[model samples]
Every structure is written in C-alpha cells, then in structure tokens.
Target: MLRYVINRIIVALPVLFGVLVVTFFLIRLIPGDP
Candidate 1:
C-alpha cells in the first residue's frame, strides 16, 4: 500500500512539475513582468 502510494506520487511529481514549468513559461511569455 505504501509502495503503491509512493509509486503514484513519483509518477505524479513529474507531471505536476511539467505543468508548473509550462505555466511559468506561459506567464513569462505573456506577462513579461519583471
């Protein structure tokens, strides 16, 4: 059970990180705020 949860988390982490990276780039491209 714990291992399953950990595995799921490991898979999710990259997806979440990717979303964050994409959002960051989109904000930077659109806002160009400093």
Candidate 2:
C-alpha cells in the first residue's frame, strides 16, 4: 500500500507539472486573458 501510494505520487508529479506548463503557455498564447 505504501509503495503504491509512493508510485502514484511520483507519476502524478510529472503530470501535474506538464499540465501547469501547458496551461502557462496556453494562457500566454490566447492573450487578452489572464
């Protein structure tokens, strides 16, 4: 159970980072919105 939780967290971290990066760029590209 502990190992599973750890693995999930590790996987989630990258996905979260990717989402943040995409959102950041998307916000910039749209312009006139923030």
Tens digits of per-residue lDDT for model 1, 1-34: 9999999999999999999999999988895647
Best by TM-score: 2
Off by over 4 Å in 2: none
Cα lDDT of all candidates, in order? 0.95, 0.94
Q: Pick out the ten consecutive residues of candidate 1 with the lowest summed lDDT.
A: 25-34
How big is the positional error of residue 4 in model 2, measured in Å on the Cα after superposition? 0.3
| Model 2: lDDT of residue 19 | 100
**Candidate 1 residue 12 C-alpha distance from true site, Å:** 0.7
- How large an RMSD does model 2 have? 1.3
Cα RMSD of all models vs. native, in order, equals 2.0, 1.3
lDDT of 2 by residue, 1-34 (tens): 9999999999999999999999999888886743
Q: Extract clashing residue pairs from model 1.
A: none
